[model samples]
Target: MSRIVFLEERCKGCRLCVEACPAHILRPSGRFNHQGYEIMEMDGQCTGCASCAVMCPDTAIRVFRSVKIRNTAGEGAA
Candidate 1:
């Protein structure tokens, strides 16, 4: 699965990340951070592509992609 973390205080309510997300998984949270700016959050499917993070001018977005593997015994591995 892919995960996106938005650094609320570092965000300035710019929609750059939203526009950059190819997966269209980002959206405004309708909530404000300590800086009084609306933050972004994940709202849909994510392809683990780093487009959003790369387009974030404030460096407020972090993307983590975890690789899950299954063994022949049907066990999950990290």
Candidate 2:
């Protein structure tokens, strides 16, 4: 499963990540951080897409994607 982490303190509440999220998992959180700006929230539905991170001007979001390896056991068996 893919996941994302947001550096809350570095976020400037620009909401660019929210708009760049294709999975619709990012939203404007009603809470404020130490900087007094509304933060963003993730719904744990990240698709490993870097769209959010690319759009974030502050580089607040980090994405981690799990690589799945498929077994090729039968490729040369026959």
* lDDT (C-alpha, whole model) for all candidates: 0.89, 0.89
List model 1 lDDT by residue over 2-78, tens digit each: 89899899999998999988888899999999979999999987788989999999999888997877567745655
The reply for model 1, stretches above 4 Å from the true place, is: 68-78
Per-residue lDDT for 13-49 in model 2, tens only?
9999988888889988898999899999887678898
Assess candidate 2 and give its lDDT: 0.89
Q: TM-score per candidate, in order?
A: 0.83, 0.89
**Residue 9 CA error for candidate 2 (Å)?**
0.4
Error of 1 at 64 (Å): 0.6
Q: Measured by TM-score, how close is model 2 to the native structure?
A: 0.89
Q: Count the backbone clashes (under 3 Å) in each candidate.
A: 0, 0
Once model 1 is optimally superposed onto the true structure by TM-score, how far is the C-alpha of residue 23 displaced, in angstroms?
1.0
Best by TM-score: 2
